[model samples]
Target: MAGLFATLAIRKALDKLSSILPAISLLASSSSAAAMVRQGHEQDLEDLRMLERTMHRIHATLKDAEQHWDIRDESAKLRLKGAQGASV
Candidate 1:
């Protein structure tokens, strides 16, 4: 169904987001902001702020997905294959 595909797309996006979050978080802290300012990298600080906002939005989407998503074996395997291909 259309709804299922949309759910799958959201799941795929979340998987991608999850994989990248740690790297983003490492660069998004208050200390990191201060370092960027001291180094005169205002753009980098702004980028970190953007990443934090993006992560918050994704987290909210994830909560919604948890409530509404239907996980079936077939779809899960498909998502796994897609992730594996992306890693290559």
Candidate 2:
């Protein structure tokens, strides 16, 4: 549950970054390492990096969700079987 929330938060942040990054690049102009990164319309580069990270995180989250779903399905199936046997 906590992991899901963290993954969702990161996903939301990445989405916002994608939308606002072009404007951010236009506003960024300086010679320092951080500032230089902002000068060359390189927000796309940052966005790409963020996307890669997000993809990795989302993949992990999906795997976890699938596993959880499988377990829940198995449990439900067992309960249904027990109920059917009792009815019989």
Candidate 3:
């Protein structure tokens, strides 16, 4: 029963995370696109380009973090199973 509760909690947390992930991604994508649309001279353009790169980097970092969480969650499930097996 405790194990079931723990699994439910983990799944709930992951579901919340999954819901927010797309909003974050869309925000990043839209911001990047907006930066590209803004007018600028050579120097300004360079700066905007840098901003775009930074935004992309941030997006990529978020993606990596989400992937890491997924890996951790999967590992947790495997560990939980192993623990249950031992108990049985």
Candidate 4:
């Protein structure tokens, strides 16, 4: 009779564990998915930062070119005016 009682107790514990197993599995999967999403977001932020830096460098280069062109245009105009005055 004692052996039968031990068997019955073990079976009851197994039954309870079986009922709880699905909930544990679901929690584990959800945690894993959340970690993956967080990692993806971090990677995207890093890419955006790199893109912003590249754009800033490009803007600076364009500004420098514009300044150079403006100086050249002014020099050409001065030369044209000087030649006209001499010819007159």
Every candidate's CA RMSD: 9.1, 12.6, 13.7, 34.4
lDDT of 1 by residue, 1-85 (tens): 4334544665576577657766655555534446646455445656656655665564455445445555466685565445334
Question: Which residue window of length 10 is worst by lDDT in model 3?
Answer: 36-45
Q: Candidate 1 has what TM-score? A: 0.39
Question: Can you tell me which runs of candidate 4 are displaced by over 4 Å?
Answer: 1-33, 70-88
The sequence of per-residue lDDT tens digits that candidate 3 reaches over residues 7-87 is 444455445655655565555555544454433233454554555554444444434444444434767556555543433
CA error at residue 77 for candidate 1, angstroms: 7.1
Tens-digit lDDT string for candidate 4 (1-88): 2223333443454456556555654554555567777567556555655544544444444334434434347674464344333322
Model 1 scores worst on lDDT over the 10 consecutive residues at: 79-88
lDDT of 1 at 22: 64
Candidate 2 lDDT by residue in tens digits, 1-88: 4334444555566677567655665555433556555545466656666775765566465445535544347675464344333322
lDDT of each: 0.53, 0.53, 0.48, 0.47
Shift of residue 67 alpha carbon in model 4, Å? 0.6
Candidate 1 Cα deviation (angstroms), residue 58: 1.5
Lowest lDDT sum, 10 consecutive residues, model 4, at 1-10
Model 2: CA > 4 A from native: 29-88
Clash pairs, model 2 backbone: none
What would the TM-scores of all predictions be? 0.39, 0.35, 0.37, 0.41
